[model samples]
Target: MFDKNHPHLFGRLITFIFAFWLIIGIALFSLNDTPAEINQAKAQTINNVGAYFWAGNVKDLGGGFIKTGETLLEGLGSSIIRISMSPRFRIDYNLGGGCISNFSLETLAKGPDLNPILTNPSFSTIIITAYDGTSFSDCETKNYLYPDLYTPEITAAIEQEYKALAQYLGTIKGKTFIILNWEGDNDIYCGTAYGATANSCPNYQKHIEGFTKWINARTKGIKSAGVGNVYSGVEFNIVRYLKNAGLPSILYDVIPNVAADYFSYSSYESINELYSGDNGTKLLSDITTAKSAISAGGGNNSNFIIGEYGFETLGREDSKNKLETVTNLLHSRGVRYAIVWNLLDSGGGFGLYDSNAVLTPSGKYVCSLYQGSACFIIQSPSSTPTPAITQTPKPTTTTVPTNNPCAPTSGFASSCIEDGTKIITVAPPNISNSNLNLTISIDIPANKNSVIWPTGYYWSATLKNWAPFTLQGNNYPGSSWLVNSASTTLSVPYSNLQPGINYIVTWDYIWDGSKWLGPPCSTLTNSLCWRLETFIRP
Candidate 1:
């Protein structure tokens, strides 16, 4: 009101608004192609979003952990941040190591134990996969351990916690995802607690399949335990378990497991203690071994994640460095997420948060996961090209006599000539960064008044078709243009295109010009087009 009262300020404000609008312009996403009922759509991912919490290896990495943890979490940038925490007793990363015993994820996520924790924004995909103090409950449903599929107590716990997590997520759609990490028994040899049991293998899968369906059917916003961000006590173990159970990629349903799109493995600096090394037969190269298997399977099969990879605090500086190196390496290769261990007070020197609640170097490493958005390439605009126009002759205005023969090679209208393989010449072969660059050369005789080139040619990215060169070069004296080819070299600014985009129509030949000399390549138009009869690949 006061600014308006002064009058001049109001005038200045109006001018400023006008100037701002002129300079800023409008964004495409916000545009409305409003035709009363139509509106533009934006893309969104519906299945799952995963992030890893880096905690494990606090004490062992040594001092000044608080700052590091903060840095690490902040680094997650745009990824759905996460925390695969455990009760202090079993999996505290601060000092004590992760689970020594196992329990169902349902038991861990149940009521009374949530509330305060769910409130933390630092958590998105929360899974309490603890394996200490408790053993896999064999007690079955109705009344027996490992009965129908799950143990009774185990089923109850999973049901209870699942309901709680679902209800909590219901309040905030898209903001967070609460995942239940199913437990695996310490079958040290095969590395799966279920130890090849039908229930643990085939039956266990069926149980999970039905369970997720049942849960999804019951709730509205609640997502099933999509089995995401799985941390391994070992990576190979997951593969080994799958192979042992005869579970194919389809069964892993990795492609369909929208909720659990990533496979995790556990690799501690303690790899030697848990896995058999080369001394035996096959060398257990930790994550390197696991990653290779996943890659060889298929690119679309599943994205690998080094979910729980941390070393003990007692680990030497050399060991600690190795751990960090391994973590970064896996992360680079589409291992979607990587989480250390829980931040604990004591036991294993491997917590991200130390005994004093400080974040270790590993903590800083983890915080990096939470901090910023992932690097996105500025590629879309440069790759997509505007389609070039090629003239299509509509059989001219007059009709030809039914008994008439093909047009003579010596005259104007030559459309009747057999469209035999016409060789088009290309210029500037080597393209930078794989951009489509091309120029076509077609044969044309010169000097008899003028020469004409063909209009209309096909271009195929898959088949690699060359466009007809329609432009008539060296005809400098007059603006009377003859041949025109539907060809151009686009400077696509990016790396190698994926499978579907390997080949492209480097040239499209077509002409609408009236200068139709003749198709006889040996005569008048020969010099113009003949110069381009052959082309060599770069």
Candidate 2:
């Protein structure tokens, strides 16, 4: 009787232990599968989505009145309300010269007689991108001796206009982001004084400098005016032309010098680079580079925003996919705000909706992305192949000479790899003075059909992130170049390097024909592409 009871008790004990272990295993699996980071990112993104209106439903229809009910802005808000059942849309109120000065705050507050898009309860924030009539010609001059000739009145007028806009927007109902000048860089091209010798024109340079100063003053004035909930800054255009001309850093500095609230830029490259699948990476690099330049210029403002981005509906059937890809990439990178170019499909073709206020495929995709819906489907294009434009070419593979002074101590091996399976190495790892010219080399697996566009970045201790290196002589070595080999060398002036601090240099991303792929790790992954070397200046 004792032996039989012992056997039964032992079996019961085993069964209890098995059940306990099973429950514990299930709990562990659930914990591991919890998408904590993803959920957090989504929550953050919901707050960052905003809109930009060019020629859209937001424009004043016929009869000298804006039809609020039939407008694109109203349509967008309504759609969002229907989908989310919440009134939390962020509207980027884009105003050209006329709208900025002519629109009355009281009238705007009330909205159009019929629809009233601006004052709709759905809006949680209002970002104003105001552009005055001051063109590039107004800012740049032909004679260096008269650098101030073309800009004083124009600058003053702009300041006054901005003051008025700020004062009015201050009384608005929600958060406000004010940009005094939208795409001010275009003024450079409009200056007749520069003629063919644009860069050589001292007047042009002086005007740019003066304009930057004026922007700073305007920003201060807006803040001093006691404008409630208004964050003011200036916006510039970020394109390969400006970057190749070595203008990104110079322009970025204008924001912080004047103590502007944030830095902003607009890029259409995503639309152009969509076929190559490098749009997202290119944009990421551009933003990182801009941040780096801003920090190096002693400007503390790090908040970056995309003022405008859009693609045409004509000829390109894959525009929707491209928009989704770019939007997702921006969200993933933690961009504060990104405004799509226009609300209506005007003749320029970047509009998200038609004149009738119907949502296009691209518009729908953008709305879905903004609304946190998993409905976006990546569709293939039904047009001619877009030519691959390589910004940085791969270098010819050659043996690293033992006598080279800039060679890394660890030698060039496949380590500290980032996106595109690329490797980076910095030479003369130890820095003693500010005059050293640091050499950077990058290597990628050789692919015959792939072209390379390499963007260089350095870590900024002050800003606590990596910034784009200000390349010397305005040489854009990263522009599209055919890659014959897998390695390339980049030179950096040591004087430009931040002294008494460690700097890690690496590539922002690589274009591999199909898409732009960044380093496997990003700011979110607890790792950034690769750490080539930590140059500590003694």
Candidate 3:
């Protein structure tokens, strides 16, 4: 209530005003720093699904098939799922339903023990048939002892085996990957042991056809997933090696045709000899080629999985060293998945943990790389028609790049932008966030039209959404967030802004949401990088 003319009153008023401004200034500075968004080009590309990583192969313990299902998703995040539907066929004999049998793992290796994995929630994605003969294949080699495959005894057995696999998998109530595979049937040392010459080899097409038919019967038809079952039977390439073993044309010639049916291959080398470990050479190099060659030979529906591929350190001290190199190679070559091939030493020296139950150094080594984008199936648009012939991507975990969280080894590496984050920037020469607010710029890409800045991300536990504050746009569109229009710039109010904590990407462009969507790059017209994520801090 002081007089208006008082000198002291004026001073007090000025001081009060300054103090208020100072408080606000401090709060504004402390609002927290948000990371700069990554500048990206206009996105118009569409993709199908998330890429899968791999870890696979295990021997059965007293755990049975259901236990194996729990173990598959539990032990290896993206590794091979245990397949146990094949039955001893005898023409017209249908297996499964009431049929039950037992099996055990003879080849034990070091790795994450499935005891805990079996309890994981993701186990729902696993299909468990009664575990049976997954041991190293035993081929009959007895000369002049070949039986006609079309006969009921054999045909029925094969069909029953397929039916069992299909029936068990058909019961899956979650996101499961079916493994329609067979191993003991492949040409192995047992073929020679039984004295069956190559010329007298039994019919290979019948067995594979039966398997495919069973899968189709279960899945409704030859779908992309069913056709892509090459990885399940990856270890049976024993056929390829048979030619060098002096087998007959009937045996060798059938390889390229049916080898991919189960994603076939076989390897008994220790990790040490596998990689040589000389300079930087890996042991799995040759093995990678064998698998790739087979996958390419098979048709589109051919799946590429390595159901069995591992070595024992007991034989070679360097066995563990070759693991990384081989894993890296497989990932790089687009062999979508693989299993470590072990359980109780039920069969070999490959168990990640000791029979006594402890993680081996090699077991730990393979597990470390099992996570993340090991094999990214990158699509390269060919000049072909509707369904583009995209090459399968290879391993993308080697040599991680700086500042990127979704590390890319090769193929299409991941973006640094998190999901649901908004962008804020201007247009013209400043189409990129690099030049903001001012109008001085040039060289705008054709993809970009109307450049609108993003309001950025703010957190509110109550909202639970990324940015939980009021929004308002001037030239942009998003104001209260709820108000969204593609054509306008968006302005979102933030409760706070922290730098490097949010996985945000800020790219500049000129797009009116409705029509123009680009910062046109000649090399990226039809291509798109829709989203990305990074390791930022909160």
Candidate 4:
């Protein structure tokens, strides 16, 4: 009896020991991950996250030296960093020791702790400027025009510099995407004035002619480099086209005329004016319009990018919201890449972090996207002293039915409608950007009979046959319906719906004997007709 009991107890002890060891191993593996492993894990979680942070106050954080640029990169978990270089400005372009070229790629790459940025496998995208001009004040006389300023000799220098840079980048390990682009819409095109009319700008025609030559030279330099991973692109503030319609726009005039690899939109137009008020309708339309223009200009839609998007915190209190709106729209739209305007706040509150290096709401939100949760990770000390944390009042909350179909989900803002009810209003879809660039029309078949309702009714649609349908509350307020056609077309911008989700659009009509009117079909009877269309917004 003693021998038998001893064998049983030994077996039980062995089993328990094995289980304990397995648990310990898991904890150790998770906790002891190397910095590279941790960074790789973080990189796998997000995509196309990047920003442009240059020129800010410095901070001394003891032994580990950190600049605002470094902090910005770490905080945002940036996979891409846009670095500008002024090759001509560099006193020592080859050996790289100079004061005038502080922001050049060579300078930044060789700076303290920044070499890792170039060598590290984490950063997937790097946009480098081939040539950056501080100001083209002499353009009034055409002396600063394209061939004049960027003569063959200058273009060749640009090419050789870029080729060397490309060769160096190629020697580095890991597959990295590199774009050699140049100054976007600047005084070269718009002159010294910000909102100058196209015609009124000094030598506008000559400037465009000069720019066309300048961009082509830049593009040729980049292409001539022959780096497999490197491509040339042109960046333009898209608003230049919208504000000056019928005039030669960047997409219309230059892009089609050049052989650049991609067109980067410095998307201030959408962020400041077009995207707001509409549920991303105008923004989507504008992008579509821009893509069409690019296609006409000999570029494909896939190569389009939002190169720079940001809002200044100087006077705009809703800067955070505005930033999030554009970011979310781009993500949802599946645009290849987007870079925020800046990282540090110098004078303009454009930086995600203030001059003190403290996290701003916009910065925090960006960090959350990278980390997959709430996070604020500072790699080094900022130059400016950090301020004391303040507690602000929480946003007010309004209660709505959990089952409400029109209720917003994650990544969306609050809606005007609070009460849970059936659809009540409809409008002819005139999905137009503020200035008009794109349009989408949804047609309701004419054969379907009207379901008349006097109180109110809304055109509704369900998500993959979910119990409730999601509708925009503000889409209907007054009577706006078209009855004079075989199929009444309604406008529903793809921006209204979330990405990766299946949506079904259902429509109903109310007739007053004279004309079919009222919006949003209500579920009054079982006999009502339903049209099912599956839409996945990118």
Best by lDDT: 4
Off by over 4 Å in 1: 1-113, 125-164, 182-236, 240-262, 268-303, 313-316, 345-347, 365-538
Best by TM-score: 4
Superposition TM-score, candidate 4 onto the true structure:
0.53
The TM-score ranking, best first, is 4, 2, 3, 1
List per-candidate RMSD values in Å: 27.8, 28.3, 27.1, 28.8
Could you give candidate 4's per-residue lDDT for residues 394-453 as a string of tens digits?
212332233544543222212211233233222222335521111222333345323321
lDDT string, candidate 2, 1-538, tens digits:
0000111223334334434644676411134432243334445544455556433343333232233222344435422211000011112222223223243323333344312444455555556544333322222232212236336675565456556656655665654545545555654444221112445544455556666666664675577668776676666664355556554323554554667776666665333443332335567666677667666655543466766666653233345544555666666666667777666654455556654444567767666554321122122211211111111111122333334323332212123333334355555544444345556554545542222233445554445444454222111111222232223333444555455544444433345544544334322343323324454443
| Cα-based TM-score, every candidate | 0.36, 0.48, 0.39, 0.53
lDDT of 4 at 189: 56
Q: What's the distance in Å from true for residue 25, model 4?
A: 44
Global CA lDDT computed for model 1: 0.34
Alpha carbon lDDT of each predicted model: 0.34, 0.45, 0.32, 0.48
Which residue segments of model 2 deviate by more than 4 Å? 1-47, 56-65, 68-70, 78-118, 132-161, 191-203, 246-253, 269-271, 277-279, 298-302, 313-317, 370-538
Give a tens-digit lDDT track for model 3, residues 1-538. Answer: 0011112223334334434644676311122321111001002111111111122233332243334334323333333344332222111012124222331221110113332332244443332222223221121222112333235543344334444444433433344443433342342333331234545555433434433333323223213234332122323434333445554322233335442233433333222222222222222354445545554555332345444555554332233443433454445445444544443233346555444333355555544444311111122222221111122222233322345343422222133222312233223211223212112111223343333223322332234344322223222210111112222233322322223322222223333543434322212435432222222222
Model 4, residue 314: what's the lDDT? 28
Instruction: Tell me the lDDT of candidate 2.
Output: 0.45
The regions of model 3 sitting more than 4 angstroms off are: 1-76, 83-146, 152-157, 176-235, 245-252, 255-262, 269-298, 314-317, 370-538
